[model samples]
Target: MHTLDQLKQYEKEFIEKGYFVLDLNNMEYVKEASDLLQKHLQKITNNSEITLYNYHAFFEDNDKHYEMQFQMLQFFREQQFAQNIIQSNIDVYQFLLGPDLEIQTEPYLRITRPHKPKDNIGYHRDTFYGTGPGEISSVIPFINLSEKSTLSVVPKSHIIPDRFFKLNQVVNTEVPKDSKRHKMGFLYAPKVMDPEIRNDVIPIPLKRGQALVFMLSIIHGSEENNTDYPRWSTDIRVRNSLTSLNEAMKAGYYKPLKDSATTQTFERLSQ
Candidate 1:
C-alpha cells in the first residue's frame, strides 16, 4: 500500500513519463499466478517444470498463439489475480482511479516466443481502441527479462500534438514479418510521426514480480523476444470510479478494487 504522497508522486511520474513502476516487495503473487495455470500446462504438455515464458514451446502448432493465450486468460480469472492488483496499489486505485473501481480486463497473460522479431507488436496507444481516458494498463513480467525482450514505449507521447500517430496516419502492424496480429499488438510502425518524436521509443525492462503502470494514452508496444527464453508478462486494464461506463461497458466489465463501502454496495446490489 502507498501513502497519499507516494500515490501522488507516482501519478506525477506517470503523467510526466507516461508510466510508473510499482514494485512488489513480496513476489508471492507471481508464483501464485503461475501456479494457477499449472494444471492446464500439464495437460497440454506433460511437462511439469514448464513455466510461463517457456510454456509456449510445448505447442507444435506455433500459430496457435492466440488460442494458448485465451486458455491462460480463462485460468487467470479463477485465481487471485484481481486481489493482487489492489494489494499492489491500494492507494493507486483510490487516489488514481478513485473508490468506484472497475477492472476492464481480467488480468491477462502475454507470452512471446524466442527469436521471433516478426511477432513483435508495433507501437500504438490503447486510447485508439476507445477504452476512454485515464485507463491504466498493468504489466508484470513472470520471469527476469533482458531489455530486448521487454516492452518498448515512447514516454510522453500522450502529450504530443494530435497530429502525431493519428488514427488515419498510422496503421496496425505485426511482428515476425508476415505473421498475424501480435499478442501484445498496438500501433505498429508509425510512418507519419516526426523523426524527433519517433526516436523516443525505448525498451522498458522489468524483472519478475515488478509491475509497470501506464496510462492508456501512452504510446507503447512489445518488442521482440531476442533471448532463448520466451517472454511472459501479465496485462490488465482499469478505469476509475467516475467514468460513466456506457451500455457497451456491461455490468461485469469492471469490478471494485478494495473493500470500500462503495464496492460492497455494488456487490450486494448486483447480486
Candidate 2:
C-alpha cells in the first residue's frame, strides 16, 4: 500500500492534469485480482437468465454477453478479491480525494471492443449523475495492456467552473454535451490543439490491473479500439462520502445498484 506522502505526489500531478495512473507492477495481490476475475467469468458463463448491457451485446450474442456481465458483477462484489484491489485504491484515494472518500461500485463491468468508423460516444464529460466540483472517479483496468482500448482525457479539464459542468439551471435538466469546456481529440475538436487553450492532448495507456483516478469534470473520450481483441475493464467511482449520496440522487447514477442475480447474458451458438 502507498503511504500518505507518495499518494500526495500523485495528487499534485493529477490536479495539474486531472488524472494519474498507479502501477501495481507484479504485486501478488494484483495478480490475485486478475485471477479472481477469470474464475468469476467462468462461473457466470455457466448460469442463465442474465441480460447484457447495450454495448456488450455488440460482439457476443445477447444471452452469452449477458452472462458475461453477471460474472463481471460477481467479480466486483466478490469480497475477497475485490477487497484486495479496493483496499489498495482506498489508501491512495483517501489522500487524493479526502479521508471521507469512499468507493462506489458500478452495476456492470465493461468489455469494450474494436470500433467501426461509426462507433463512438463522441466528446463528453462524466457528469451523468453529479453536479459541481469534488466529483471524482477511478477506473481499474482488468485487461493486460495499456493500449487495450484506452480512454483519452483532456488535462486539467476539471478546472473548468461549475457553471460549465453543471446541468441546466433553468429547467434543471442535465447538459447533454459539455459544449462550454471544449472537446479536443479524435472525432471532435480538442482543447489542447486549440491555440486558445494550449493544452496538449495525450493518449494514456494502462497496464493490466492498474488503477487510473481522475476528476469527473475532465474532458475525455476513447479512440476506436483498433485491436481485434476485446478490452475488459471496470470503473469504480470514488468520492467524498458526503458527495456520494448527493451524486447518486442526481438522476441516473447507482451507488451499488439494488439487484444481485439479474444481469446481461451472452448465449453461445450450438456446439
By lDDT, who's the top model here?
1
Query: Which regions of candidate 2 fall more than 4 Å away from where they truly are?
Result: 3-5, 44-59, 78-83, 105-107, 116-122, 161-201, 243-271
RMSD of 2: 12.5
lDDT at 171 for candidate 1?
47
Candidate 1: lDDT over CA atoms? 0.66
- TM-score of every candidate relative to the true structure: 0.77, 0.64
Q: Write the per-residue lDDT of candidate 2 for residues 1-271, one digit (tens) a residue.
A: 6756677778888879888887653357656665666665545555332222223434355345435445565556655444456665566765665655444543335555555422333335665334335556666666654553676677887777645542322221221243211110112322222222214445578777676777877766554666665556655565654443553453434342111122111112222
Q: Which TM-score value belongs to model 1? A: 0.77
What is the C-alpha local distance difference test score of candidate 2? Answer: 0.53
In order, the Cα lDDT scores of the candidates are 0.66, 0.53
**For model 1, which pairs clash?**
103-255, 118-175, 118-176, 118-177, 119-175, 119-176, 122-187, 122-188, 123-187, 124-187
lDDT of 1 by residue, 1-271 (tens): 5666777788898879889887664578776666666667666756787766566576535557666766666666666574575466656666777666666545656677877654555566766556666467888777776787888788887777555554536544433433333323323443333434447788888877777888877888764677877777777877776665444554665676545687788879999
- Native-to-model Cα distance after best TM-score fit, residue 7 in candidate 1, in Å: 2.5
